[model samples]
Target: MNKQEYMNCAEEELLHTYNRFPVVLERGEGVYLYDTDGKKYLDFAAGIAVSAFGYGKKEYNDALKAQIDKVIHTSNLYYNTPVIEAAKKALAASGMDRIFFTNSGTEAIEGAMKAAKKYAYTRDGHAGHEIIAMNHAFHGRSLGALSITGTRHYQEPFEPLIPGVRFAEYNDLDSVKKQITEKTCAIFLETVQGEGGIYPAEKEFIEGIRKICDEHDILMVTDEIQCGMGRTGKMFAWQHYDVKPDIMTCAKAFGCGVPVGAFLMTEKAAEKSLVPGDHGTTYGGNPLVGAAVSTVFDLMEKENILEHVQEVAPYLEHALDALVEKYEFVSARRGLGLMQGLVLNVPVGKAAAKALEEGLIIITAGSDVLRFVPPLIIEKSHVDEMAEKLDKVFAQIEA
Candidate 1:
């Protein structure tokens, strides 16, 4: 079937959740994607920043294939070699003493919340602990994750969500402090807000949060689902600020392309929270995802993916800065490492659609920001190609 036929079939069968793009992507090669109609697109979205190693890396593929032959899964009741290795590597990467794997970022958040509440309960011998989350922050779509997500519209329809989640202003330390009470057990925020528009946490703001958590004995929970795993030129975005979170939720590029996520905590948080039977998942860290996770970390070290991101991010930033300077509609460029955004006066949705037509794939964050989260394997040439295509996109928008 052709592209439109496939799209129509999908719409007919699938539930209407996402307003998917017009193109039906067939496959990806490195930093580019091809549609069913054979049009090539320089991919800046990178499947929303999940394809860290880009498409079809031989080492990653080989690891998965080898694991497929060995074992795919064994229930959490049994121990598996791949999950053991994956856990050790993940703990080492995050500097966290304990880990709980989940199938997705949302599940990680749910686990983190439960752990935090359990910790507070263990300490005070009571429950009803509140969590302070930043306004405009986007955690996930699940009930527990969505409750703490500060956006109103997303929560209005799913009213009476897990209560006791208070909203605070992002980057405003004072606002965070005002929301804290003896009942406040945890504070959640994205290290670099992805869906809220690529806003990196300010040095003072994140550091201040650490200090507050330390003084109050509240767990600092950072959602690094989008900005972790070398997306920000560091293993985790919080590392850039030299501040450690008590509980860190990670997914996206954690397993590169596989479905896996984890909520990790320091030894201190581990000592008081979520003992056995508190949390369990049948397929969270099964052999299949474990192989993907372990291989992703192995390749990260073997290939020096972090250093490569550090090297190329500045060039992409420079190109984007030039666009901001050249275009009247482009107001600002903000973000860290490869996860960047351009704040525009024009409609971001229209601009993204135009870029797709020009054989480039870019996405939007918030309402006015054009998000750029290309694969970590992207090079200077890919950035150049993106800029050239975006220039045409901007020109068309102007016309």
Candidate 2:
């Protein structure tokens, strides 16, 4: 069907959760997406950082096709070879001891929260067990993840969320220390805050968190859903700081477009929390999702994706810096590697909309930040194309 027809059908049937752009993407290749009307646009959003290998990579496609031919899924009750392989690779990649696969990032967050709380409950007897999250942090939309999310507007609508979740200022060790009580069970923060406008954690801040977690026995949970899997030129963003989280939640690019996510924990936390029947998922680590995940990791290794991201990321940051310099309304550029954001004095949603009209796809992180989370395979040429389109869009938008 045509773009208009697809959009009309979507409006008629689909839930209105997203204020979607007036475009229906039919297919994608490399860093470009084609609309149903055959219009081409550079995809800087990377399907919100899920399409890491970019759309239609031969290796990724082949792996999924091969797996589909063999078997799609079997219940988690029986062992799946692909599931074992995927879990091994994921554990190796993140340097975490144990993993529990889930269907999405929100599920990962929920699982992490449960694991942390359960561990605390084992010792603290379930009384006053609290979680401290950061101000401006965005974990997920589930009731558990939403409780720890710091934004009031998102939480205010769903009143009386899971209790004992408190917010602290991001990057401020003092604020975190102040929030800590004897009842505190875990401290969860994003290694790089994505939806809160691409803020990378300071080295001192992460290190301090590690120290506090050590001293107080609080689980340090880092949500790496948006910034992990070589998006930040490393296997995980926490590696950049040289401080490890006791538990980490990863997704988005984890399955390379397949629906998969996981919560990984250190051996200590793993042994202490979530005994066999505490939590489970039917499709979490089934053969289908497992194949997609293992293929992503295999391709990352075979293609040297981490090195490519490291090499090309500077070009992206340089181009974004140029925009910050040229546009008076553009205030700053911040982020690690390809997961960058251009802070705007104007509304970010307006700027992104304009870029979409000019054959470019960008997204908003917070209220006034344009997020640039392109595919890891994008080269200097694609960066130039994105910057050029963004420049035109910036010129059209008022401060």
Candidate 3:
């Protein structure tokens, strides 16, 4: 279909749920996308940080196809080989004993929250079931995750959310310390805050969370949905800090584009938390997604994905930093690895729209930060193309 056809379908027939860019992505390859009009654009957003191994990875395709031929969905009531194997790989990589798979990132957050509070309640009592999250942290859109999102805009419309939730300043050790009372059950945070302008957790702050959780006997949960799985030049972002969360939630790039989410917990935490028949979904951990997930982890091991990011990230960072010098609108560039953000003096949405019109795909976060989350397989040449297009976009932005 053409762009006009899609626009008509969207404006007339579809629900006004998303604030989308004025373009229809028809097809994609590694680091590039074709719009409905056949215009090729340098894809820097990577489907909002989902296409981990880049578009059209043969191994992932093969794994998925093989599973599709066998069985796609056989209700979660019985055991399935692909799901079991995938669980093994995901659990091993996460450094946790047990895991519960879900359909999306929000479901993963809900499961993690339930497990955290359940474990705390089972251990002592229900009074100590409070959850403390960071300000500007984005977990997911589910009611449970939204309850602890710490963003007023996403929470205002849906009031009377989950109880025993409080917000603390991100990367502030003192804020965390003051909030963790006797009622605190889980102290949740993103290893590298993705929607909070790509701010990584300070080492001292993470270590402080670990110490405080230990002292209060509360659960430390890291939401690595966007920052995990070699995105930050590490398999898990928490590995950058000297902290191992009692529970961890991850999704987005886990299946290399397939919809899959997982939450893992330590033995003590898992023991008191989830049990058989306590929670599940019909499609969660289905064989098809399991095969794809197994393939992704296997490739992550053999290909040394993090090492590749370590080599290529510096060049991309330098290129984006150079943009700040050339364009007055770009204020700063910040992030650890591939998940970098371009903080702008001008409005990020306007700059992103300009980039889209100029044959580039980018995203915007809170405030004026333009997000750049290209696939990890992106090379220096792709980075150069992105920089040139984004430079023009920034130059055209009204300052």
Candidate 4:
């Protein structure tokens, strides 16, 4: 069937959750994707920053294939080699003492909340502990994750969400402090806010949050789901600020395209929270995703992905800045490393549709920001190609 036919079929059977683009992506290689109509697109979205190693890496694919032959899954009741290896590498990378794997970023957030609440309960011998999250922050779509998400529209329809989550202003330390009370057990924020536009947390603001958490004995949780795993030229964005979170939630590129996520905590938090029966998942740490997670970390080291990002990210930032300078509608460029955004006065949705027509795949964040989160494997040439395509897009839009 053709692209439209496939889309029609999908629309008939599948729930219409996403206002999907017209193209039907067939496959990807390196930093490019191809649609069913045999059109090529220079990918800047990286499947929303999940394809760290790009489309197909021989090493990563071989690891999954080999693991499939050995064992695809085993109950959490039994020990598995791949999960054990993944746990060790993840712990070392995050400098956290304990880890709980989940199937997605939302589940990781849920687990983190549970751990924080359990820690508070264990400490005070009571419940009803609250959590403070930043306004405009986007955690996830699940009930527990959505409750902590600060956006009102997303939560209004799903009314009466899990209560006790207070919204604070992003990068405003005073706002966070004002929300804290005896019942505040945890503070959650994205090290770099993704869906709310590409706003990197200010160093002072993140450090201040850390200090507040330390003084108040509250667990600091950084949502690294969108900015972690070498996307920010560091293993984690919080590392750049030298602020360690008591609980860190990671996904996205953590498994480099596989369905896996984890919430890691310090030894102190671990000792006081989420004992055996407190949390469990049948497929969370199964060997299939375990192999994917372990191989992702291994390839990150063997290929020096972080170093590549460090070198190329500045070039991307510079190129985006040039567009801002050249175009009247382009207002500014903001973000860290490869996760950048170009703010525009025009409609971002129309611009994105035009980009797709120009054989480029880009996405938007917030309402007016053109989000550029290319694969970690992207080169300077890919950035150049993206700039060229965007230049045409801007020109066409201006016309």
Error of 2 at 379 (Å): 0.3
Model 2: per-residue lDDT, tens digit, 240-321? Answer: 9888899999999999888899999999999889998999998898888999999999999999999999999999999999
**Candidate 2 regions off by >4 Å?**
none
For model 3, how does the per-residue alpha-carbon lDDT over 1-399 read when each residue is reduced to its tens digit? 678888879988888999888888888877788987889988888888888887878878988998899999988888999878888988788788988888888898999998988888887856447899999999988789999898899999988889889899998999888887777889999998888798988899999999998988889999999998889998899988867999998888888788998898899899898788778898989988889888988999888889999999999999999988877667888999999998887778888889888898889888879998889998999898888887777666643
lDDT of each: 0.95, 0.92, 0.87, 0.94
Query: For residue 2, what is the lDDT in candidate 3?
Result: 73
Model 2 residue 353 distance off true place after TM-score fit, in angstroms: 1.3
Model 2 CA lDDT for position 88: 98
> Which residue pairs in candidate 3 collide?
none
Worst 10 residues of 4 by lDDT: 251-260
The regions of model 3 sitting more than 4 angstroms off are none
| Separate clash counts for every candidate | 0, 0, 0, 0
Q: Give Cα distance to truth, residue 321, candidate 1, Å.
A: 0.5
46-85, model 4: which lDDT tens digit per residue? 9999999889789999999999999998889999999999
Give me the displacement of residue 279 in model 2, in angstroms: 0.2
